[model samples]
Target: MNRRGLWSVRWRSAVVWVWCSFCLLTLASLTLRYIVLYIHPDHDTHRERWCPPEPVESDECYSWRPVLLPHATCGCTRRILIRHTCSEDLSPKMWDGQANSTCDPDGSVRGPQQLVMSISTPFLTPKRLATLSYTITQVNELYRGWVLRVYTRVNKHSLPSLCSLVCAHPNLDVCDITAMSETANTVHHAAWRWGVVGDPLVSTWALRYLHHALLPRDAHALTQFINSNKCWHLMKDHPTHSHSVLGSGLLAGKTSWGLSELTGIRKRILLTRHVVEEEQVFRDMVTPVIGRDVMTHDSLTCYTSAGAVPFPSRRSPGQWVGMPIPTLTNSPQNQNKSHKNATDIMPPQLKVFSVKYNSKVNTTDGFQIIKNQADNDDVNEMEREHINRKNGIPRCPHSCRPPLHPNWDYC
Candidate 1:
């Protein structure tokens, strides 16, 4: 072949090699992208799957499973708990005749049964359905012996504003309010989620849980969502996954110390490390203090999973969040005797814990208003117990709900 022909062939070969190299690089990049997505599924799609509707109008949230976690923070678990916890005044000074003093007149006070729809937002939780539902079929069975009603646009939002609207219109019943909005079709549509889904099971269950469960659990959910008032960057293990480093937040609040009380915990160690070093950090800092008590360890060490970004993790160190209180020993024999003095408290929770004290059990429960008193206070406690029983009230089982972040799986 001539020199010119040979040079032409070489040039063609070089072009082909460059093209093949580009394609291979593109394929590799795509593969790496897929792997990253698989390891850390984009929570947005998960949020979209779980929250199909707008966050505020999600018919309450789908991910809010009926399962309650052991470390729930408030008496706000199911809708019943929301009604019982959010409505009924927890104050000892609240007179017996006026049980609904703190509750919205148009809301929790008006009906013992309620159904709630909540928006599931990544940053915020629906806090006030004070109601719940399951897959019950019959509509009548669901709302049996309960009043099903739609009341307010303001109620569609939080009660703080609608509550004020209700005071002026005390005579306006839910039917009246719902009817008043009927002609204003758009108004009703936004607030009217009743029978929204054609599915009988979903619709009837929503109705039943709204009323029978006392309140929609969403109400309780909102009550517990104080972990953060507004959505901000989460600096901990995405609130859903279990980890060994936990911390309180400007909004991601702490869990109950009661679980520690019940389980008999003493020393709790919370550690923070670069998100890149999550496993190593847990092994090095937290494991020893927690010993092999897996449950306790997981619950206490929740904040460590902040993503590996250097800037964010620096601000949020893993923390020891539970109250500094005495806990029972691991041994059954010394268990009760170990935490004999639980009276000492850190703060905040001490304000309202007075509601559960029993004279017989000596719950050692304290109140912010009435800390320590003489034997006469025991008489007062007995009187309070009788009043509570008379009212068919029980001490709230949940004052808080479990974490709602996509990472934590109460299910």
Candidate 2:
């Protein structure tokens, strides 16, 4: 019994040790998973806990608590700025005069008769807020017939600040898409599903099409599209190209510039007089700067010309006509002085507009417009030439003339 019993006991001991080790490892793995999940919860699961299953009018439906980061100060908590209940109505409203108009002789409802322009941005920083406000003022002043709508991502707490910044213009409506769900049956939900998640290239495309679809059949309207980063201004009237769609061509392919063609596509804000019948044709004509087939390198149509709206160019000098021009100074004394007298230096039109809003924003931090050295020099030279011409002096031929001297009257 000595040799056989000893071997059998050793084998049984090995089997028991292996099974105990396996059970311990499994228990440890499950514990670690639970710990990780407790520390950093899944976003979808958290959303489901708060967001209502159906549209609700209560503010509690969109309530969100501030999230504190680990080891961070209590003041450094991250808070969602805007949140709206699913039932909250944020639809665009027609201008006052258009409200009374009928669709046809039969007194039926028609699509939007007024020009509807829209712009979308996920983040609404201070700079974007100012640009948007200024654009709205300009649109209201220049094109009284058009209606502008703004779509951005923000939470309930931050929305009032934005609305106040924009002065809550009647012709413009600001819509928030932060709480939009793809599964919802609302118009915004449909557009949200159409958009490619996390892709900024086509972020505004779906909303633009949605607005067009809501318009009256064969309606004659103009769509002025741009992103939050870009500013739009009416430089001059282009009645010739008013009926046709226009966009930029400088960025047709990836090789054209180091930037993606999609960036150029954002610059291609179309101004169309009539809505097209087909969706594909409408997209192609509305956004000709970048091809519809984003995966392929198909030839893109560029429409940069006199009639086309001027887009910010990475390679060329920036235009100052429609841009905010801020005096640059490093001296703290000068900066303080500039800030104090900001309203005095503003254009008469802007001064008048600002009075209407009674905006509380510090003028010094109103809007920051960035321009390159070449652009600054070009703008300076143009101003000098204008002064000389006004005083009955001829423009100096820079090519033939020597370097400018203090005593020189002409080249």
Candidate 3:
């Protein structure tokens, strides 16, 4: 061939070779992606599990994870894009301005990172299992979602100090504690209120009441607090004020969640000072009527009347079923009104039946009003007969007779 034709052939061949290599690489990449997709159809760079087939009724899909990177720390400035309909980025106001802000979403990932630890058949470490138990208590405070405790080794080498996500629905059986821990990153320990008795059942009613009654009463403040993301802070910090802030319009507890189901599904977020704080809160609440040590046996007898204080409603707040439950009405705003006048704000004809203050009753009469409720008349009659057979003075009216045993007494 001629020299020019030979060179042209060589160049064309080179060009063809480069093009073929590029096409082959592209095909290989696509094949790899398909294989990965088949294996993990729900994987995401964001670490959130891909949303399964579900009704997309809401504005945004419910994704709990945010891919917390190792770089981000509390109060640090990181560029993260918040995809929620409400905001473009995580604002400084959300974390009480303790964290720095940057509206830029170029690189930073928001929220908790997906736990990368793998799961095995059984966890192998005694020490890590112990630490995991401690970690679960901390995680339960923030994320109340259901998870499983796993105690197994990965690859038979790495110690199992890790928690895995237990989201395998229908595919897996009982979830392990390891799955629960995977949902959170570094748990910054904070002081939480003790034994406030967080029944999700009660919380549902309480939250509804707060949203309807309490929020409406002080609409401006409530709106501001909610908008500024201060409601969570108030709940965590000023627990006493939290009740008033949300309780002014609270309805009574309901019975939607069966006790059996609640016990199984609902998890307890154990806090450090649960019992101590619970006692303090109770003392603060009932101190005016029963005084300190109101949680004692004497106080318990007084609390028997609690059932008679009707709960709000099973569904809606303020909508009574059998009877209306009594709630404290005097917010700091309107505390000086006459007790009788305060009834105007409350449901008319509703009374705190079967509940009476010892302070409200006089103790002078031997034939005082029967302390036993009218509902217990049969039991009272039996007691009366027994008392008469013994040494009986006439039945003590409006109260139960003192037992002959010196140690036994009623408050």
Best of the candidates, lDDT: 2
Q: Candidate 2's C-alpha lDDT?
A: 0.32
Residue range 1-411, candidate 1, lDDT tens digits:
545653787888998999999999999998987787778653112111111111333343322212221112111222211222333353323223442311123233332223232111111112222111111111112222222333334333444332322232222123222233333233322222222112111111121112222111112122223222221112221232233243211011111212232112111111212233433443453333332222211221233332211110000111112222122123434322312122212122321232332221221111011123222233444565565445333332121113332221111
Overall local distance difference test of candidate 3: 0.26
User: Which tens-of-lDDT digit does each residue in 1-411 have in candidate 3?
Assistant: 555664787888988999999999999999998788779853422221121122344655443433223222122232222323344344423433231211111111322211111112233343333223323332232122312122222342332222121121101111222323432111111111111112221221111110121211122122222223111111111112223321222211111213332222212322223434423433343222221211111111212321111111111112211122234343644333322232333323222211222223222211122232223333344554454335312222222212332221211
**What TM-score quantifies how close candidate 1 is to the native fold?**
0.21
Error of 2 at 199 (Å): 22
In model 1, the Cα lDDT at residue 314 comes to 9
Give Cα-based local distance difference scores for all models. 0.26, 0.32, 0.26
After superposition, which runs of candidate 1 have C-alpha atoms over 4 Å from their true positions? 1-12, 21-54, 57-305, 308-320, 326-411
Note each model's CA RMSD in angstroms. Answer: 22.7, 24.9, 30.5
Q: What TM-score, over all chains together, does every model reach?
A: 0.21, 0.29, 0.19
Worst 10 residues of 2 by lDDT: 212-221
- Poorest stretch of ten by lDDT in candidate 1: 310-319
Q: Write down the worst ten-residue block by lDDT for model 3.
A: 307-316
Model 3 TM-score (2 dp): 0.19
